[model samples]
Each structure stands twice: as C-alpha cells, then as structure tokens.
Target: MFDKNHPHLFGRLITFIFAFWLIIGIALFSLNDTPAEINQAKAQTINNVGAYFWAGNVKDLGGGFIKTGETLLEGLGSSIIRISMSPRFRIDYNLGGGCISNFSLETLAKGPDLNPILTNPSFSTIIITAYDGTSFSDCETKNYLYPDLYTPEITAAIEQEYKALAQYLGTIKGKTFIILNWEGDNDIYCGTAYGATANSCPNYQKHIEGFTKWINARTKGIKSAGVGNVYSGVEFNIVRYLKNAGLPSILYDVIPNVAADYFSYSSYESINELYSGDNGTKLLSDITTAKSAISAGGGNNSNFIIGEYGFETLGREDSKNKLETVTNLLHSRGVRYAIVWNLLDSGGGFGLYDSNAVLTPSGKYVCSLYQGSACFIIQSPSSTPTPAITQTPKPTTTTVPTNNPCAPTSGFASSCIEDGTKIITVAPPNISNSNLNLTISIDIPANKNSVIWPTGYYWSATLKNWAPFTLQGNNYPGSSWLVNSASTTLSVPYSNLQPGINYIVTWDYIWDGSKWLGPPCSTLTNSLCWRLETFIRP
Candidate 1:
C-alpha cells in the first residue's frame, strides 16, 4: 500500500521484472544446451546391442542353473530388467538347462519358460544359446565309444527333446537368434590334450564329423518342427591355425552341409591383445579369415554373429575404454550382433557387473554406447546459437576409363591360388602411358556355390604397400561392393602410375559374406605374387 505510484517503486518493479526474465532466459538456454541429438544415423546405430546373463541357483549364488526364488537369479534378472528398460539394450539369456545332463532334457526344455520377462514388448529380440552338455571333443567318445551314455535310442531321444525346445522357442513372436550348440570347437580342441592317445585323445576329424551330424540332426529337427521367426546357427571357437591349415574337419566342411541361417564365432583374443597395445587388428583378421572360410564353403547368404566378446583390464577405466573401442570395431565390420561374455563378473574377471548387480566400469561404458549417448552425443557450448539447417549438395559423378591394359603374371603371390577353371586375367601387362587403363575378367565356375564379385588390388611402389582398388559397379544391395552374379568384368584406371617403377595389379574375388578369396593382394598374405607388372615410358 506504500507509494503504489511512486517513481522509486516503479523503478524497483522494473528492475525485478528485468532480473526475473534474464534468469528465465538463461535457464532456457541451459536446457537447450543439454546435448541435442547429433544426427539421425547415429541414433539408429545403437539398436541391436545385447549382453549375456547367468543368475546362480539356490544352493550356489555364484554357480548353477536358474531355480525359482534364487537370489542370484533374481538379482541377475533385475539387472537385465533395468538394462532392458534402457533404450536399445537387450539381454542374451544363456539357457543353463542345456548344461545339465540329457537325463534332465525336460528340465532343460523348461529353460525358455523361465524367461517370461524377456517376452515382454520392451525386449525387441532374444538370443538364446541352446547348450548341449557334450563338448566337441566328447562328441565322438560320448556318442560312439560310450554307447551306454548315448546309444542310438538315447541319441534319438535327445534329438526329440531339442526339437521340443525349438518348437517352444518358435512360439514367441519376435526376432530370435538361437545358437544350437555354443563353441563346439572347444569340446574337440580344449577338452583333450593335443597328441594324446587315440582312445583318450581328440580325433579332430571324427569330432568334426560327429559335431556335424549332431548339428545337422538338431537343425533338421528344429526346421521340421516349423520354428518361425527364429534364426539358427552353430557357434565355433575361432579356427585354430593347424586345424584350418591341415584338417578336413574345418568349418568349411561342416557349415555348408547344414542349413544354418548364419555362422557365429567367439572372439576373446582382444582381451589379451588389447593390453599389449593391439587395437583389434588381430581380431579383425581372425574374423576376416573365418568369413573367407565360410564363404568358400558356400555359406554366402549366411550372416555373421560375434557370439561372445569381453575384456577386463587392470583398472575399470581401462576396461571401459577397451569395451568402447572393440564394440565399435565389431559394429563397423558388419557383424550382426555382439553379446558381451557375461553380465556379472563371476570373479574370473570378464563380467560387466559385480555380483551385487551394480554396473562395473566396463558395464557403464557399454550401457552408454547402447543408449546412444556416451558414444553418439557431441558436446557444444551452451551459449552457442543453433545454426540453420541447409540442404545437402548433390554429389557429382566422375567418369572413369572403360578400357585398361592388364595381363596375368606367374610371379604374383597369392594366399588362395586360383582354381584352374576360375582364372584372373589382366590385359596388356607392359604399359608406356601414364593413363594406364586395365581390364580384369574373371570366369565364374558354373558350379560356384557362392556369389562372386570383382575386387582389385594395386601395389604402390612408392609407398611399398598393396592398396585395394575402388571398383566401379552396382554394389550388391546392402553390401559394400560385393555383387551377386556369375561373372564380372571391371575396368580400372591408374592415372598416377609412376614412370620407370614396377607396379603390380592383382585381381581377386570376394565370395559374398567372406573376405577376398581368389588372391590375397594386400599385406594379409605372404604368398608369391600371382599378378605382376611394370609401367615404363616408351
């Protein structure tokens, strides 16, 4: 009531209004600064992230299959539930029941029943590994030598039980990834000492045959049962060097025969290699080799799955950084999915979370990548004004040479030698002009099981390295540059060819879903060059 119209009161009121508006304006600016979405492409990148979880049973909270009311299982589920609530994160449920004996097939069959929570709409996909307690090395011994344990009748019974489990899984209407047997190679290689006696030792070939039979039977049973919305595959440990080089029991022999929708391999090399300062080059090479083998075996259409990968460094920060680096590497390589090895650190050191369901450092980093925040967001000045969006300019097309001189040379080294019928030809090897036009033609074998595509490699004399050529052609849909035809001819132009220096142009082919197969043109192989050339002035 004091001086309502007084000059001093009016001035004070005006001052109060100005200060209030200024505070509100500053808050609005702060709110706007709270990390805007960087781009739409990054937002979609987090969709398929997943992890593995195993909750202990009642008797042992740290080990044992899931039993209702088990505190560990409940805690594990709670963690999964929390992760599921996070956008773009899913849980990979390892069916512990499979680890039990065949006598408990029915109990194992109930494993899916225990995951009712996973069926919720929030969970977009479920990846279940149906473990068969029999390890790969034990496959031949248990199924053949030990007749009492797995007789013909008993094997048939086990097949039927797996079929039942598959049928149950198919009933759930969502994208589902099922690994029929996890790490079958381990059973063959790890369970037995190398060079042990025949009876007690691992018969690598026999083990492969037995594993193939088991996989085929299980695959057929699941298919015959009409499992819908399910992608099935068998998981193998990364191929051992000796096993791949000399054994007939390789993945190439097994995968093509079975009707697997995809192939999966577990990679733990990064765990040891990361600390030594290797940034997944070894892991990537392994993956490339595996894909090449699979594709050579005619599993061209099969996608790849990184069934398991994890790391545990000396410090939590180190572990988190490693996780971020490797996960990004996997995603960039066209891997369909990567499930972290374990959700809880079982005291052996790879778990993303502690036993108490709290996220460890690696887990937090993983969670951030999945949520599209820690990896995707770009921090900006809170006070910077938002820029106006502009239309993107259309790319201009460059005209490439249609004719090139190339000739096949015997001196060229290649990891994969060309089959006699499938030849790589480069025309007019010795060239004088700087605008070196090269044409490469590949004769696709009529019985070629895989879709063949053209890929070229050129040796950089100056750089002393072999660099891959950028092919010009219609890319196979959804693939980088792979094609789905019988034969392909590519014209390459090298305008930067150095005079008086020898250069090599190596022709190669990539079978769909695999690495370069016909020739190893890059530094990946030490084989003698198969395509050699020198550009000289006339």
Candidate 2:
C-alpha cells in the first residue's frame, strides 16, 4: 500500500512540474514578440504627419473666395476624420507672397464662407511657409562693393511681412511653425548680378551673408513680439546643385546664427531617385549632412523638417509606391515633420488630388501612411526605366602601401560594416594638431551593374550625432560617378575637424540601382552604419 501511494504521488509531482515549465515558456515567447519599439515609433509618427498646399483645394476658388467645403484641405481633414474618428490633423499652411500679407487673421480664423478648412476642428497644428516676392535677384548683387545694394529694402520688407504673419498666427488656435522665406536659395539663381560667374560674385556672397543675418533678426523679432505657440525659422532648398557647390553648410548656418527655432529644407530627389531605390537613403544622408553642417557652423539648432516633397502623376504609374517608401523612411528616421508638395494636381503634376477633390493613388497612399494604416501596397512602375545617376563612384582597388602615413593601425579589413555591405577606414588615427588632412576610404562588394554615391559624415560631440563633413573647394566628389572598383578615397582638412574631440567618419548610404539602402544600423538600432576610426585630438 505504501509503494503504490508513492508511485501515484511521484506521477502527480511530474505533471505539475511539466505544466509549470510550459506556462513559463509561453510567457517568455510573448515578451520576446512584443513590438515595443515599433509601437512606440508609430505613436510618435502619428504626431508628426503634416500637409503642404501648393495649387490644391486650399486655394481660393473663383469669386475671390476660398471654397472651404469643396477645398482639398477640407477634404483631407474629413477623410482623416472618417478613418481615425479623431480631429488631430496637422496642416502646413503654405502661403506665397500674396496670401501671406493679404489674408486677414480674423477671416482665416473663421475659414472660407462655405467649407472653412483652416479653422476645422480636425487640425491640431498649423505650419506656415511664407514666401515674399523677394527673389534671388533681390538678395544677390553683381558688385561685391555693393553687396548691400540689392538687399536692405527687400530684407526690411520681408521682415515686416513676417512680423505681420507672426502676429496674426500667434492668435491662431493651435501650434504654429513659421518659415519666413520658403526656398530662399532660389534667389541665388535669380540674381542677374552674378551672371555666369555666380560664385565669384562677392556681391552674391555678401547678399547671402546679409540675408542670413536679416533672417536671424527677423526670427528674433517674431519671438520678441510675444507670438504665442509660434516657432519661426527660414527654409532652404536642398539639391545636388547646392551640395556640389558646397552651399548646404553655409546655408544651414543661417538658422542657428539668428537663433531660429528649427532648420528646414525641401527635396524633390526622392521622386527622381525612386526607381533606383536610393531616395530614402539619399534623403537620410542629406538630413544628416545638414545637421552636421549646422553644428559645425556653431549653430545649435538641430530640429530638421522637410518643408516640401512630391512627385508627378503623369508618365509614372509607380508614384504611389515611391511616396509610401519615402514617407516610411522619413518616419523611421525620426524626422519631426514632412509636408507633401501640393494638395491638388496642378499642371506642375505633384498634386496629391485632382481639381475635383478626388484622392489620387498617391494621395491615398500618403493619407494611409499618415493615418497609421497598413494598406499601402508597393506597385511596380509601368514606364521607361529611370537612368541610374551615381553621385559617388567606387574607386579602383589597389594595395595599401605599408609606407603610407594615413593608413589605419588595424589595416583595411572588412569590419565596422554598414548598409550596402560597405567598409570604412580612416588613416593617421591619432590627431596632434589642427592642420592634418584626414584621409577616408570606403570599400563595398564589387557589383558590375551598380553605381555608387557615397556621402561622408562625422560624429559631432556637441550635437551628440554625426554631421556631414564640409567638403573643401566646393568639390562634390559624391556626385554620380561610375564605379569601376569597390573602394574610394575621400580627403578631409584637419583644420575643419572638431578639435579636442573624437570623430567617427562613415558613409550615409549607398545607391545600388534598385534602391537606396542605408547602413544596417541607424539612430534607432543602437548602432550607426560603421565606426571607421575615433580621431582624438591631443
């Protein structure tokens, strides 16, 4: 009787232990599968989505009145309300010269007689991108001796206009982001004084400098005016032309010098680079580079925003996919705000909706992305192949000479790899003075059909992130170049390097024909592409 009871008790004990272990295993699996980071990112993104209106439903229809009910802005808000059942849309109120000065705050507050898009309860924030009539010609001059000739009145007028806009927007109902000048860089091209010798024109340079100063003053004035909930800054255009001309850093500095609230830029490259699948990476690099330049210029403002981005509906059937890809990439990178170019499909073709206020495929995709819906489907294009434009070419593979002074101590091996399976190495790892010219080399697996566009970045201790290196002589070595080999060398002036601090240099991303792929790790992954070397200046 004792032996039989012992056997039964032992079996019961085993069964209890098995059940306990099973429950514990299930709990562990659930914990591991919890998408904590993803959920957090989504929550953050919901707050960052905003809109930009060019020629859209937001424009004043016929009869000298804006039809609020039939407008694109109203349509967008309504759609969002229907989908989310919440009134939390962020509207980027884009105003050209006329709208900025002519629109009355009281009238705007009330909205159009019929629809009233601006004052709709759905809006949680209002970002104003105001552009005055001051063109590039107004800012740049032909004679260096008269650098101030073309800009004083124009600058003053702009300041006054901005003051008025700020004062009015201050009384608005929600958060406000004010940009005094939208795409001010275009003024450079409009200056007749520069003629063919644009860069050589001292007047042009002086005007740019003066304009930057004026922007700073305007920003201060807006803040001093006691404008409630208004964050003011200036916006510039970020394109390969400006970057190749070595203008990104110079322009970025204008924001912080004047103590502007944030830095902003607009890029259409995503639309152009969509076929190559490098749009997202290119944009990421551009933003990182801009941040780096801003920090190096002693400007503390790090908040970056995309003022405008859009693609045409004509000829390109894959525009929707491209928009989704770019939007997702921006969200993933933690961009504060990104405004799509226009609300209506005007003749320029970047509009998200038609004149009738119907949502296009691209518009729908953008709305879905903004609304946190998993409905976006990546569709293939039904047009001619877009030519691959390589910004940085791969270098010819050659043996690293033992006598080279800039060679890394660890030698060039496949380590500290980032996106595109690329490797980076910095030479003369130890820095003693500010005059050293640091050499950077990058290597990628050789692919015959792939072209390379390499963007260089350095870590900024002050800003606590990596910034784009200000390349010397305005040489854009990263522009599209055919890659014959897998390695390339980049030179950096040591004087430009931040002294008494460690700097890690690496590539922002690589274009591999199909898409732009960044380093496997990003700011979110607890790792950034690769750490080539930590140059500590003694």
Give the top-scoring candidate (TM-score).
1
- What is the alpha-carbon lDDT of model 2 when measured against the actual structure? 0.45
lDDT (10s digit) by residue, model 2, range 1-538 = 0000111223334334434644676411134432243334445544455556433343333232233222344435422211000011112222223223243323333344312444455555556544333322222232212236336675565456556656655665654545545555654444221112445544455556666666664675577668776676666664355556554323554554667776666665333443332335567666677667666655543466766666653233345544555666666666667777666654455556654444567767666554321122122211211111111111122333334323332212123333334355555544444345556554545542222233445554445444454222111111222232223333444555455544444433345544544334322343323324454443
What's the lDDT of the predicted structure labeled candidate 1? 0.46
Off by over 4 Å in 2: 1-47, 56-65, 68-70, 78-118, 132-161, 191-203, 246-253, 269-271, 277-279, 298-302, 313-317, 370-538
TM-score between candidate 1 and the true structure: 0.50
- After superposition of all CA atoms, the RMSD between model 1 and the true structure is 27.1
Please give each candidate's TM-score. Answer: 0.50, 0.48
Candidate 1, residue 278: CA error in Å? Answer: 1.5
